[model samples]
Target: MSTAVVPGIEEIARVQGRTVRVLAAGQVLGGVSFGATVSLGALLAADLSGEESLSGFATAAVTLGAALCAIPLARLAGVRGRRFALTLGNAFALAGIAIVILSAALRLFPLLLAGVILIGAGNAGNLQSRFAATDLATPRRRGRDLGTVVWATTVGGVLGPLMITPGEALGAVVGMPPLTGAYLFSIVAQVAALVLYLVALRPDPLALAQRIALSAGPSGPVVESDRPVAARYAMLAVAASHVVMASVMAMTPIHLSHIAHAAHGGHAVETTEITLLVGTTIALHVLGMYGASPLFGWLADRIGRVTTILAGLGILTLALGTLTLWPDEQPAVVVGLFLLGLGWSAGTVAGSALLTESTPIARRPRRQGLSDTTMTASAAVGSVLAGIVLGGPGYGALALIALAIVAVTALLSPLGRR
Candidate 1:
């Protein structure tokens, strides 16, 4: 018979508040690095490979790396706790950034891919931190807590792309390749995140939750019934949404550059204009992704996860439809991308909250890890195919394809009355 050692509700709430604050701070800094990398990774790949066709490889590598690392990190969290796993993930990102700098200096495409893969591992940690927020949360507040952490990323995500021109200038001052300078900023940002995680994430939320549950006796906390089915549905929804978002997002910069050049009568587009367009578009998209998460979370808790997911699909369809109608138009592209981010935000937050609610406490981390792995792996495949489609039938066709996928996801959703 296990003795009950449950902490008081007020104590639990206090710890939860502290945990979220620390996680949010780390996420902000981590977001800076990730946002900058997202803006530059594909461009750097195209430049290094000397083939626009391979542009997707960089994003794909990052997603694939995230996929590869997700399970291991989750297992580590399961065994050692969230702090250990998060710290290790940041370390991998730091090392990867270093290698990326070296690869850029030497103009080695393979090495660059290797380094990006490590950065992806770090992303796995960053992504998992949102879930960590839910470990000690009351069932009623799970979505809201998750949303707060996701929303925190907005600060860094918005600032990241705006740093590109300055990052290049910094590179020039340091006698480094322009494209490589972002990694320098990334290195510093990741180090700060790693240190924050190591020093501040106290009481180890997962371990604490586990102890509290065990203290409740052999019956444990009341877990949801039909968890397996709900878990499967949640995973599918999250993965499908991620595929749509990553496929289009991964190809956006390349598309923007091509159209800009064509509009200029086959001459290279001015760097300043390209930076302005891409940076502004990406900044807005990130805003859409993170800014509305709180509302979506509240909706998830109030309306239901399935309804939130269906709403996300509707928004995604609208986004894809807009892109299909106005393929190369900058304003339309910006609107579509922003909608895309918004839709993804809805699907991801709702689906993740549902997954957490549905799974058994002891098994939550593993299932969450599996969900992330599937999401990123599908995203990797979508990204690679996106490159092929964009290079062949063009952006209009790509939008049509994404729209079709959204339709299929809707049809397959488990939301209908059973």
Candidate 2:
């Protein structure tokens, strides 16, 4: 049997503050890592592969990598500790950055894809950090605490893309090829996160939480882990919300590009112009995604988790409704995408807090890992299916389809435990 050692209330409280700060710092750096690559990865793939069509695969590769890594890393946290798992994940990202730079220089497409995949895997760890924030939180304040960490993401996410210009200059100074320089920043950011995890994430929140739980008994406190309903609902809420967000967000750029092409009357527009439009719109979407997380998190705590989740669905419906009704309008699409990000933030933050409180401490790691895996996998599937749907019926139709998904999710919400 595992030894029953639990953290004292005062110790947990003290460490929780430190843990949040370190994790927040890690998120900022992590945002730099992911934000840079996600924007640049496809462009790099297109350049190296000499195939524009192949560019789409870059994001998919990252999504697949994150999905594949989520469960194993989560389980690692179960065995080793949050610090170990987080450090390993960021290290993988740092390594990926190196490989991406080398692959660009070598003109090796396969190698580039491999590197992108590893970056995705590293993202899986970044996703898990939200849950780590809740390991020792009181139920009354869980959503608020998790939201604060998530809110920290706004700083990094916004800064990541903007850093590209400077990152490029830095890379040029050091003789890096164009487009590859941004990843140099990625490397630095990821390494900083890795070091932060190593040095500051002391006492290992999950491990310490485990000890605190074990002190409750051999089975640990809160045997709800033995019950499937609450855990399953929490997981479903997060996964469903992610799928909707990913599916819609994935198609928005393609739809915008098509609009640009049509508006230009088949004249070839500069790729950079189209990219700028897409990038600016997406940046706003990301802002809505991370910037207001603290508000939603607070709402989740104050209004109740399931209520906030349902409210997220309402936002999704409004966003999708806008997209469906005004598919050809650029301004409407931009607004819709921003709203989509807001809805995702609310659902993910609230659902995560719910998952933490609902799951048993002894089984927390595996379940949390599994939830992330489910969330990422569903998103991958959603994004793929979205492309198909968008290609077949058109952008408006795609919004309608996603709206149906949100409806189904809302239908299921009634079955969830508060």
Candidate 3:
């Protein structure tokens, strides 16, 4: 017997439109906090530890925290729905930001690390928001929907780093440490994000999608199994790309600072100059990361996920190559970083779409969580190693190491042959 049809196109579109709008708004606000943190994380670590080598530890802690929180958040999304999971994650981030301010005020390194990790947990939730956009999406438009949410981050991400100077000014006025200023802004933005999710994300997209699927009977999108191997490859693609991005990105500010100081003939870099350099470079990088996601998503749908992933690998290789060849050139470094963000966007968007399509509905959340866990964990390890390499052999060496990883990932990619 024939099964009942799923919801009509108009109904699905209505839900998808609302879901995307809410998710996009949340991403914009959340991106502000994330962008500020990324710009300041390693610098804060350097200040707290009094050692450049340990700077990566700050970002590493964040990634590790995200890794630890990934599964729990995913399970929460699975059981409680996306609104609950997203809000809870934001709450953790808000708390963590408060602790970060306290840690900075006290000069407590341990507390700083702990607080940053909690912030990372919030980041885990932000990452998952892209997937939430897909619950009500039609198969044909999944990539586009997911890419739109990813693209939404660009506004806040670019704006966040630019706030560094003003944040510092605000902190100084309030007797807070210089590095801690951006986090105050982070707190406000994250709170706004939390409130938005709590208020705007009504009807819980995942729950609604499941209901529609069930009502459609046996012919619905729900399936019993998926190819474990393909899912694993998709996870690997995302993880490897993230590792490259994180490792290089974690140390870039430090690298730039060092270059600036050296350029000034061993004089300390001017704070204004440092802020301008880091903020502009990171803004460009953020732009690369999210600006063209819609295009990449379109490519993923048209050219195929696997093929798009391979293209990401190629872009990454070029990025690493640029950095490796011209480690000291500011323009080249900017180009390299921009390419790095673009490559990450391509890999993550395409890999996520592939993984989602390949997995059964019932298993999707858990598997997606696992994928993010692995991705962040590996990135944490890479960040730690990046610190060591940057301290010893320098940025060029780090680039080379990341390049080797990308090569290995390409070889293992299911799309390599395709």
Candidate 2, pairs of clashing residues: 5-211, 6-211, 6-212
Instruction: Return whichever of 2 and 3 wins on TM-score.
Output: 3
lDDT score, residue 180, model 1?
A: 70
lDDT of 1 at 249: 89
- Looking at model 3, which ten-residue stretch has the lowest summed lDDT? 216-225
Off by over 4 Å in 3: 1-8, 216-225, 415-418
Candidate lDDT (C-alpha), each:
0.87, 0.81, 0.88
Model 1: residues with Cα > 4 Å off, grouped in runs:
1-4, 217-226, 415-418
* TM-score leaderboard ranking: 1, 3, 2
Per-residue alpha-carbon lDDT of candidate 2 for residues 385-417, written as tens digits (9 for 90 to 100):
666676678779988988987898788886567
Scored against the true structure, residue 375 in model 3 reaches a CA lDDT of: 95
- The window of 10 residues in a row where model 1 has the poorest summed lDDT is 216-225
Q: What is candidate 2's CA lDDT for residue 190?
A: 88
User: Per-residue lDDT for 1-418 in model 1, tens only?
Assistant: 2335766777888999999999999989988888887888888899888998899998898999999999999989988999999999999899888888888889999998999999899999999988999888877788888888999998888778777778877888989875776667787889999999999999888887777766744423324334777778888889988999989988998999987998899997777677667777888888888889889988988898889989999999999999999999988999999999999999999999889888877898899999999999999889999999999999889989989878987887774212
